[model samples]
Target: MAQNTDGGNPFAEPGELDNPFQDPAVIQHRPSPQYATLDVYNPFETREPPSAYEPPAPAPLPPPSAPSQSSRKLSPTEPKNYGSYSSQASAAAATAELLKKQEELNRKAEELDRRERELQHAALGGKATRQNNWPPLPSFCPVQPCFFQDISMEIPQEFQKTVSTMYYLWMCSTLALLLNFLACLASFCVETNNGTGFGLSILWIILFTPCSFVCWYRPMYKAFRSDSSFNFFVFFFIFFAQDVLFVLQAIGIPGWGFSGWISALVVLRTNTAVAVIMLLVALLFTGIAVLGIVMLKRIHSLYRRTGASFQKAQQEFAAGVFSNPAVRTAAANAATGAAENAFRAP
Candidate 1:
């Protein structure tokens, strides 16, 4: 009972009924993929169609699993979202690195700016460079849109005017001191028939003049040079000491070298008239000094505000302009063009 008579024929080209395993150590060899390259065939070139083999289809999904379940399969032709995930992650990391670098650069810039400001302060004797706030505003601007919007209704702060209230008042006081000295000379002339005689007090006026000039003027000049609030404060205190000395002198109080002097004796003897006049001058100076104090406070506030403004501008500039790659590229292009044009220009 044979399905075919091929077993009885040895040279029958081996019928389909033949047992391939019965061949003595011989087997049919598969067409190896090593012989394939781009579906080409030749001794030097062998290829196969790229579409010859396909990855298995995912088994028919079991009847829709519960909404909580999901599938994880890697079928050929299915996009590997991993690539997208990696790209997104790489982009995020690069952006973070860029931001960190930008922030670091901003920090360095701010530090440099602060150091420069400190150098300026030290060079100028620690005064703020900005001018005084003064000339109080009207309750409202006459025009609908005031040209000077940033300036307040309560104070004036024109950037160019360097004189503060204290400087102005000190200048006036210095002028008054000079006038008083001149008047004393005139009074001395009126008293001495020969205009050559010197009073015991003439020497005191001469001494006081230089001391007052030094006490206030030097510091005011330094304040102007530095434009600093710290210098103003120092100047105010030192000048206050000078003012106190004047008050004591005017009241004929004893003990500042002239306290027990022949000048004090003469001053006390004429205290009623001279003391009253000196007290009037002192009161006027007091009022001006109070005005200066107000201006100093206002300027200090503005100084702090300017620093804050610089910081804000730095942050916004870094975020909007410097951090943008497109902007950087454009800036680079512009710089290159400018350099090339400059070089070409004879």
Candidate 2:
């Protein structure tokens, strides 16, 4: 072998001098130096070897996230949807107001209808032509009803309850009278000497039932219905008399006719059952007397509040008398007769 120009081992294998680690096939498969730098193992830094796969193109660089509603800020140029929420609230409020107005209109319409009906009813003969419904007589009964008693129609709203209470009290009084009659009958059966009480009880029921309806009840009703001072005075007078009668009845004067406390106690020695019945009737009468007093006071208070007076009552009476056609004619006839008599005398 020729001596080498550069210093070399002459005894070394020829392939060793030409780089024994190099192979043509291996070199063809090996990656380039730049790609090999990507595979360098460093303890402090990490790297992945690049291959023909190209690392799946770095996972497409995950898309950026949008900002949350709380984090996002609005600009003046970008209009907010606040108008939509405000309009919804305003629409709801308007709907509620409209409903309230509609309800008021409905109430007014009902009131108008009621007034129209009243006007129509009153159109005939300058008075209401409706049939009397009070006394509640049957269709087949020969006796027709006498009055038209509608508290709602005749009395003011403030007085309706008081009038209704009075009506109920009257009904209670009638029932109490009926019960007294039965009690007196029982007493009479127990003692033959009690016949006077039984007879008087029947008379009391028959006499007082219609009389009470006419005297105090009717006057009070008329007082409230027309606010008549005269009617109020009449009620006070008659009701005072009624209260006296109630006291007398409750006293139970024997033989004078009432199943009262005295009669009940007297009969207790003779018969316990009769005594008990008379006692209950006496209690009923006593209750009526007390209720009468309370009702009188209530009515007096109501009267005072109404500004009614004796002068008003006199004026009402005078107006009523003068307005009567029969009274006017009689007065005119008397005046003409007096004038003729005076002329004749002269």
For candidate 1, give the lDDT: 0.50
TM-score of each: 0.27, 0.68
Q: Show where candidate 2 strays beyond 4 Å.
A: 1-118
Per-model C-alpha lDDT, please? 0.50, 0.85
Candidate 1 per-residue lDDT over residues 1-346, each given as its tens digit: 3345545444435353256665654543333464354444466645445565567897886787545313566579976664567898998899999999998888667656655765775688644433332223454855332121111221222421434444465556555455344433443444443133134345556665556555664545444443444445555677667656544433432322222122234443444454334344445445544555565556456556544344554555566576799999999999999999999999
Lowest lDDT 10-mer window, candidate 1?
146-155
User: What local lDDT score does residue 135 receive in model 1, on the 0 to 100 scale?
Assistant: 27
lDDT of residue 287 for candidate 2: 91
